[model samples]
Target: MNETLSLFGLATTPLELLSFVLSVVTVWLNIRQNHWAWLFAILSSGLYGGVFFDAKLYGDMGLQLVFITVSVWGWYQWLHGDDTHERLPVTQLTARGRAVAALAWLGAFAVLAWFLRSFTDTDVPYADGFLTAGSLVGQVLLSRKRLENWHVWIAVDVLYVGLYLHKGLLLTAVLYAMFVVMAAIGLRAWRRSMGQHGQASATMVLK
Candidate 1:
């Protein structure tokens, strides 16, 4: 299924086209806060792993494996990760939590960049490593229903567009561009969800 075809004047393989479609669906479900998103995330990540491997983007290829593993944990977290074992609600990270997340992203980027540069023949090790690290952080936050996950996604997706284009993966670049807009919509939607949850809690307390 790796046959190349001209999709909207851009050459892409069947594998990439399939991956793009599944990824879009995955993000759409994520915006809706549907648990089913994790399944699609797993599927798309598996497919994209192969796509990135062919492109020699070793960091991204490795990231797909990570994504597959995380998706399973994320799926369970969405279903039963709350303190009370309830369905998780959209929430923002505290200032300290945010600081820790930032540190984690930076540390992961440093280590991944060094590893990719030292061990892979990929041409854009730094960009690949940086975006890969940010994606991991974003995925973790998203798994926990954190509102700020969209912010990480927005930043990473924008950079990924350029990275994919440079690697001649035109279709994947378009996918990342679309992800930027979808991530913005997800941010707004999740914020509204958090506000509604807050109002509901306040009502219960007042009653």
Candidate 2:
């Protein structure tokens, strides 16, 4: 029997099962606009870092470190990173912000892919780099409470599901599949919030 498949009733690695639970909780909390999710994010990232390291997915392993930092930054952002020291509202990316995010994603992909290609013997460097880069963009957007973050997550998590499957991380693949669904749900919920806010602003203007 595979030890990795000996954990929960679902039969996954201990780290995988734990990370899966933490990540799911993190996403669900985020969907409800809760800041506590970041704490879980940090823990999940740490566990996944070890899992990816053992799996020889060096790029993803490095990404887990980045995720730890991003989770910390996000925690602060949700609590007091607002310009007015108040809770930040769901917002849209500015046109310039969109451009910058695009450039950042491209640059991250190029640099990480090159580094993985030159320094690591990992076979999925490009795929790993691509997903890692996308995660960076998604994490930043999420930290800022940008509504579009869910879209980024949906796109990347789908690819992640496939990649984890290819890498034989069955549990991680299942988690990413659920991430895709959660991202979609988050997008819809956030869109409703945006609409409600818009209506409120228009009503205020009329009054």
Best candidate, lDDT: 1
Best by TM-score: 1
lDDT of 1 at 96: 100
Residue lDDT tens for model 1, 28-63: 999999999999999999999999999999999999
Candidate 2 lDDT at 19 equals: 80
lDDT of every predicted structure (CA atoms): 0.97, 0.88
For candidate 1, what is the lDDT? 0.97
In candidate 2, stretches whose alpha carbon ends up further than 4 angstroms from where it belongs are 6-11, 201-207
Per-prediction CA RMSD (Å): 0.6, 2.2
Angstrom error of the Cα, residue 121, model 1: value is: 0.5
lDDT of 2 by residue, 1-207 (tens): 125565344557777778888989999999988999999899989988888987789988998898899889889888887789887778898999888988999999999999999999898989999989989999999999999899899999999989998888888888999999999999999888888878987999999
Pairing residues by index, what is the TM-score of model 1? Answer: 0.99
Show the colliding residue pairs in model 1.
Answer: none
